[model samples]
Target: MESQAAFNYQQQVEEIRLAMGCDFVALALVQSEERHFQIRWEFASGNLSQRFRRIVLHSGKGVAGIVFKTGKPIFVPDAHQYYKKEDMYNYPILIAEELESFAAIPLFKYNRVKGILLAGCRKQKCMSIEKFELLQSLVTPTFGPYYSEEVTGI
Candidate 1:
Protein backbone atom coordinates (compact mmCIF):
# COMPACT_ATOMS: atom_id res chain seq x y z
CA MET A 1 0.00 0.00 0.00
CA GLU A 2 1.10 3.55 -0.56
CA SER A 3 1.99 5.70 2.41
CA GLN A 4 0.18 8.89 3.31
CA ALA A 5 3.22 10.92 2.39
CA ALA A 6 3.20 9.42 -1.08
CA PHE A 7 -0.48 10.20 -1.50
CA ASN A 8 0.10 13.74 -0.35
CA TYR A 9 2.82 14.17 -2.93
CA GLN A 10 0.36 13.17 -5.64
CA GLN A 11 -2.16 15.70 -4.40
CA GLN A 12 0.48 18.40 -4.39
CA VAL A 13 1.55 17.57 -7.91
CA GLU A 14 -2.02 17.77 -9.06
CA GLU A 15 -2.48 21.12 -7.41
CA ILE A 16 0.58 22.48 -9.12
CA ARG A 17 -0.60 21.19 -12.46
CA LEU A 18 -3.98 22.82 -12.03
CA ALA A 19 -2.48 26.09 -10.89
CA MET A 20 -0.03 26.27 -13.75
CA GLY A 21 -2.57 25.05 -16.31
CA CYS A 22 0.05 22.66 -17.58
CA ASP A 23 -0.55 19.42 -19.39
CA PHE A 24 1.59 17.46 -16.95
CA VAL A 25 3.34 17.69 -13.62
CA ALA A 26 5.35 15.02 -11.88
CA LEU A 27 7.59 14.35 -8.94
CA ALA A 28 10.57 12.00 -9.10
CA LEU A 29 12.23 10.83 -5.94
CA VAL A 30 15.38 8.96 -5.06
CA GLN A 31 15.08 5.37 -4.02
CA SER A 32 16.51 4.06 -0.79
CA GLU A 33 20.25 3.89 -0.23
CA GLU A 34 20.10 0.14 -0.68
CA ARG A 35 18.85 0.75 -4.19
CA HIS A 36 21.89 2.92 -4.91
CA PHE A 37 19.76 6.07 -4.84
CA GLN A 38 18.19 5.47 -8.22
CA ILE A 39 15.41 7.89 -9.18
CA ARG A 40 11.90 7.18 -10.41
CA TRP A 41 8.74 9.14 -10.97
CA GLU A 42 6.66 8.59 -7.85
CA PHE A 43 3.86 11.06 -8.37
CA ALA A 44 2.30 12.50 -11.48
CA SER A 45 -0.73 14.47 -12.66
CA GLY A 46 -2.17 14.50 -16.16
CA ASN A 47 -0.04 11.55 -17.20
CA LEU A 48 -0.62 10.00 -20.58
CA SER A 49 0.13 6.44 -19.49
CA GLN A 50 1.78 4.19 -16.95
CA ARG A 51 5.06 4.10 -18.85
CA PHE A 52 6.59 6.66 -16.49
CA ARG A 53 6.39 4.15 -13.67
CA ARG A 54 8.63 1.79 -15.58
CA ILE A 55 11.34 4.34 -16.19
CA VAL A 56 14.22 4.63 -13.74
CA LEU A 57 16.91 7.25 -14.03
CA HIS A 58 20.32 7.94 -12.58
CA SER A 59 21.95 11.30 -11.90
CA GLY A 60 22.75 13.30 -15.05
CA LYS A 61 20.59 11.10 -17.23
CA GLY A 62 17.11 12.49 -18.02
CA VAL A 63 15.34 15.76 -17.23
CA ALA A 64 14.90 14.80 -13.58
CA GLY A 65 18.43 13.49 -13.53
CA ILE A 66 19.89 16.73 -14.83
CA VAL A 67 18.06 18.87 -12.27
CA PHE A 68 18.83 16.46 -9.45
CA LYS A 69 22.49 16.27 -10.42
CA THR A 70 23.01 20.03 -10.76
CA GLY A 71 20.56 21.24 -8.09
CA LYS A 72 19.38 23.76 -10.66
CA PRO A 73 16.31 24.22 -12.81
CA ILE A 74 15.98 23.66 -16.59
CA PHE A 75 13.49 25.31 -18.88
CA VAL A 76 12.84 24.10 -22.39
CA PRO A 77 10.50 26.69 -23.85
CA ASP A 78 10.45 24.84 -27.12
CA ALA A 79 11.19 21.15 -27.15
CA HIS A 80 11.31 20.93 -30.92
CA GLN A 81 13.83 23.73 -31.13
CA TYR A 82 15.83 22.61 -28.11
CA TYR A 83 16.26 18.92 -28.93
CA LYS A 84 17.44 17.49 -32.19
CA LYS A 85 15.60 14.57 -33.78
CA GLU A 86 18.32 12.07 -32.91
CA ASP A 87 18.42 13.23 -29.29
CA MET A 88 14.66 13.17 -28.77
CA TYR A 89 14.87 9.61 -27.49
CA ASN A 90 16.97 10.79 -24.58
CA TYR A 91 13.95 12.50 -22.96
CA PRO A 92 11.30 9.84 -22.65
CA ILE A 93 9.02 11.98 -20.48
CA LEU A 94 8.74 14.63 -23.16
CA ILE A 95 7.79 12.06 -25.75
CA ALA A 96 5.48 10.22 -23.42
CA GLU A 97 3.61 13.38 -22.50
CA GLU A 98 3.86 14.79 -26.01
CA LEU A 99 5.21 17.95 -24.44
CA GLU A 100 6.36 20.83 -26.61
CA SER A 101 7.75 22.77 -23.67
CA PHE A 102 8.76 21.87 -20.14
CA ALA A 103 10.64 22.88 -17.03
CA ALA A 104 12.15 21.01 -14.11
CA ILE A 105 13.25 22.13 -10.68
CA PRO A 106 15.43 20.43 -8.11
CA LEU A 107 13.84 19.40 -4.85
CA PHE A 108 16.37 19.56 -2.09
CA LYS A 109 16.65 18.04 1.37
CA TYR A 110 19.51 18.17 3.83
CA ASN A 111 21.21 20.58 1.46
CA ARG A 112 21.20 17.96 -1.28
CA VAL A 113 19.02 17.27 -4.26
CA LYS A 114 16.60 14.50 -3.37
CA GLY A 115 13.78 14.99 -5.83
CA ILE A 116 12.66 16.74 -9.00
CA LEU A 117 9.41 18.54 -9.82
CA LEU A 118 8.59 18.84 -13.49
CA ALA A 119 5.91 20.88 -15.27
CA GLY A 120 5.20 20.58 -18.94
CA CYS A 121 2.85 21.70 -21.67
CA ARG A 122 1.67 19.74 -24.71
CA LYS A 123 1.48 22.85 -26.92
CA GLN A 124 4.41 24.95 -28.00
CA LYS A 125 4.64 28.43 -26.39
CA CYS A 126 2.29 27.28 -23.66
CA MET A 127 5.11 27.28 -21.18
CA SER A 128 6.10 30.91 -21.10
CA ILE A 129 8.79 32.67 -19.05
CA GLU A 130 6.06 34.11 -16.83
CA LYS A 131 4.72 30.63 -16.22
CA PHE A 132 8.17 29.35 -15.38
CA GLU A 133 8.67 32.19 -12.95
CA LEU A 134 5.33 31.44 -11.38
CA LEU A 135 6.39 27.84 -10.96
CA GLN A 136 9.61 28.90 -9.31
CA SER A 137 7.81 31.25 -6.98
CA LEU A 138 5.30 28.61 -5.96
CA VAL A 139 7.95 26.11 -4.87
CA THR A 140 10.63 28.35 -3.52
CA PRO A 141 12.28 27.52 -0.16
CA THR A 142 9.99 24.54 0.43
CA PHE A 143 7.18 22.52 -1.05
CA GLY A 144 5.69 19.60 0.80
CA PRO A 145 8.56 17.30 1.84
CA TYR A 146 11.16 18.95 -0.36
CA TYR A 147 12.86 22.30 -0.80
CA SER A 148 13.02 24.11 -4.11
CA GLU A 149 16.44 25.36 -3.20
CA GLU A 150 19.34 23.58 -1.47
CA VAL A 151 19.34 24.82 2.10
CA THR A 152 20.68 23.62 5.42
CA GLY A 153 18.21 21.95 7.76
CA ILE A 154 14.48 22.50 7.34
Candidate 2:
Protein backbone atom coordinates (compact mmCIF):
# COMPACT_ATOMS: atom_id res chain seq x y z
CA MET A 1 0.00 0.00 0.00
CA GLU A 2 2.84 2.35 0.80
CA SER A 3 4.54 1.73 -2.50
CA GLN A 4 1.27 2.24 -4.28
CA ALA A 5 0.81 5.58 -2.54
CA ALA A 6 4.28 6.67 -3.54
CA PHE A 7 3.56 5.67 -7.11
CA ASN A 8 0.38 7.69 -7.05
CA TYR A 9 2.25 10.68 -5.74
CA GLN A 10 4.69 10.44 -8.62
CA GLN A 11 1.84 10.32 -11.08
CA GLN A 12 0.32 13.44 -9.59
CA VAL A 13 3.59 15.26 -9.94
CA GLU A 14 3.78 14.37 -13.60
CA GLU A 15 0.24 15.56 -14.08
CA ILE A 16 1.17 18.86 -12.48
CA ARG A 17 4.12 19.30 -14.81
CA LEU A 18 2.00 18.66 -17.86
CA ALA A 19 -0.74 20.95 -16.66
CA MET A 20 1.71 23.74 -15.93
CA GLY A 21 3.55 23.37 -19.23
CA CYS A 22 6.77 23.36 -17.34
CA ASP A 23 10.08 22.32 -18.85
CA PHE A 24 10.70 19.97 -15.94
CA VAL A 25 9.18 19.02 -12.68
CA ALA A 26 10.32 16.77 -9.83
CA LEU A 27 9.23 15.92 -6.36
CA ALA A 28 11.33 14.98 -3.33
CA LEU A 29 9.57 13.44 -0.39
CA VAL A 30 10.69 12.48 3.04
CA GLN A 31 10.29 8.88 4.07
CA SER A 32 7.31 8.40 6.34
CA GLU A 33 9.14 6.08 8.69
CA GLU A 34 11.44 8.95 9.68
CA ARG A 35 14.39 6.63 10.17
CA HIS A 36 16.41 9.49 8.76
CA PHE A 37 15.44 12.95 7.55
CA GLN A 38 16.74 12.00 4.14
CA ILE A 39 15.08 13.29 0.97
CA ARG A 40 15.13 11.84 -2.53
CA TRP A 41 13.67 12.87 -5.84
CA GLU A 42 10.90 10.34 -5.99
CA PHE A 43 9.37 11.53 -9.25
CA ALA A 44 10.39 13.48 -12.33
CA SER A 45 8.91 14.67 -15.60
CA GLY A 46 10.61 16.01 -18.73
CA ASN A 47 13.87 14.61 -17.47
CA LEU A 48 17.09 14.56 -19.47
CA SER A 49 18.51 11.76 -17.35
CA GLN A 50 17.63 9.46 -14.46
CA ARG A 51 20.65 10.31 -12.35
CA PHE A 52 18.59 12.39 -9.91
CA ARG A 53 16.65 9.36 -8.81
CA ARG A 54 19.63 8.04 -6.86
CA ILE A 55 20.64 11.22 -5.09
CA VAL A 56 19.67 11.66 -1.44
CA LEU A 57 19.46 15.13 0.12
CA HIS A 58 19.92 15.89 3.78
CA SER A 59 18.15 18.66 5.70
CA GLY A 60 19.46 22.20 5.04
CA LYS A 61 21.74 20.89 2.33
CA GLY A 62 20.24 21.66 -1.07
CA VAL A 63 17.33 23.58 -2.52
CA ALA A 64 14.79 21.05 -1.40
CA GLY A 65 16.47 20.61 1.95
CA ILE A 66 16.57 24.35 2.55
CA VAL A 67 12.92 24.75 1.68
CA PHE A 68 12.09 21.69 3.75
CA LYS A 69 13.83 23.17 6.77
CA THR A 70 12.54 26.74 6.43
CA GLY A 71 9.08 25.87 5.14
CA LYS A 72 9.48 28.60 2.52
CA PRO A 73 9.51 28.72 -1.22
CA ILE A 74 12.80 29.30 -3.09
CA PHE A 75 12.78 30.86 -6.53
CA VAL A 76 15.94 31.14 -8.56
CA PRO A 77 15.61 32.59 -12.04
CA ASP A 78 19.29 32.09 -12.83
CA ALA A 79 21.10 29.51 -10.80
CA HIS A 80 24.46 30.75 -11.99
CA GLN A 81 23.73 34.21 -10.63
CA TYR A 82 22.18 33.04 -7.39
CA TYR A 83 24.36 30.08 -6.56
CA LYS A 84 28.02 29.41 -7.17
CA LYS A 85 29.23 26.43 -9.19
CA GLU A 86 31.12 25.15 -6.16
CA ASP A 87 27.83 25.05 -4.19
CA MET A 88 26.04 23.23 -6.96
CA TYR A 89 27.23 19.85 -5.80
CA ASN A 90 25.22 20.21 -2.66
CA TYR A 91 22.14 20.08 -4.84
CA PRO A 92 23.04 16.90 -6.64
CA ILE A 93 19.55 16.57 -8.02
CA LEU A 94 19.90 19.92 -9.80
CA ILE A 95 23.32 19.08 -11.24
CA ALA A 96 22.33 15.54 -12.11
CA GLU A 97 19.09 16.74 -13.60
CA GLU A 98 20.91 19.58 -15.38
CA LEU A 99 18.67 22.35 -14.15
CA GLU A 100 19.81 25.97 -14.63
CA SER A 101 16.76 27.81 -13.33
CA PHE A 102 14.36 26.57 -10.70
CA ALA A 103 11.94 27.06 -7.89
CA ALA A 104 11.56 24.86 -4.84
CA ILE A 105 8.30 24.86 -2.91
CA PRO A 106 7.61 23.09 0.33
CA LEU A 107 4.74 20.68 0.66
CA PHE A 108 2.97 20.71 3.94
CA LYS A 109 0.91 18.10 5.66
CA TYR A 110 -0.59 18.98 9.02
CA ASN A 111 1.38 22.19 9.12
CA ARG A 112 4.70 20.42 8.66
CA VAL A 113 6.84 20.03 5.57
CA LYS A 114 6.30 16.61 4.06
CA GLY A 115 8.04 17.09 0.74
CA ILE A 116 9.39 19.48 -1.88
CA LEU A 117 8.27 20.23 -5.44
CA LEU A 118 10.80 21.58 -7.90
CA ALA A 119 10.02 23.05 -11.32
CA GLY A 120 12.91 24.05 -13.52
CA CYS A 121 14.36 24.81 -16.89
CA ARG A 122 17.72 23.88 -18.38
CA LYS A 123 18.40 27.39 -19.58
CA GLN A 124 19.26 30.42 -17.49
CA LYS A 125 16.53 32.95 -16.66
CA CYS A 126 13.88 30.80 -18.23
CA MET A 127 11.61 31.24 -15.24
CA SER A 128 10.24 34.55 -14.07
CA ILE A 129 8.60 35.96 -10.97
CA GLU A 130 5.25 36.00 -12.73
CA LYS A 131 5.55 32.34 -13.56
CA PHE A 132 6.62 31.62 -10.06
CA GLU A 133 3.60 33.47 -8.73
CA LEU A 134 1.35 31.58 -11.09
CA LEU A 135 2.89 28.31 -10.04
CA GLN A 136 2.35 29.24 -6.43
CA SER A 137 -1.23 30.14 -7.15
CA LEU A 138 -1.75 26.86 -8.95
CA VAL A 139 -0.28 24.78 -6.15
CA THR A 140 -1.67 26.57 -3.15
CA PRO A 141 -5.36 25.63 -2.97
CA THR A 142 -4.76 22.12 -4.26
CA PHE A 143 -1.86 19.80 -5.30
CA GLY A 144 -2.38 17.08 -2.73
CA PRO A 145 -0.68 17.21 0.65
CA TYR A 146 1.48 20.28 0.03
CA TYR A 147 0.25 23.52 1.53
CA SER A 148 1.89 26.83 2.28
CA GLU A 149 1.74 27.89 5.87
CA GLU A 150 -0.39 30.93 6.42
CA VAL A 151 1.62 34.09 6.91
CA THR A 152 0.42 37.31 8.42
CA GLY A 153 2.06 40.18 6.67
CA ILE A 154 3.26 42.98 8.89
Q: Lowest summed lDDT over 10 consecutive residues: which window, candidate 1?
A: 1-10
Computed on alpha carbons, the lDDT of every model, listed in order, comes to 0.85, 0.79
Against the true structure, candidate 1 has what lDDT? 0.85
Q: Which segments of candidate 2 are over 4 A away from where they belong?
A: 1-7, 140-142, 150-154
Alpha-carbon error at 35 in model 2, in Å?
1.9
Off by over 4 Å in 1: 1-7, 140-142, 152-154
In the predicted model 2, the residue pairs found to clash are: none
Cα lDDT tens digits, model 2, 77-131, are 9899988888888878778778888888887776778888888888888878877
Report the Cα lDDT for residue 36, model 2. Answer: 83
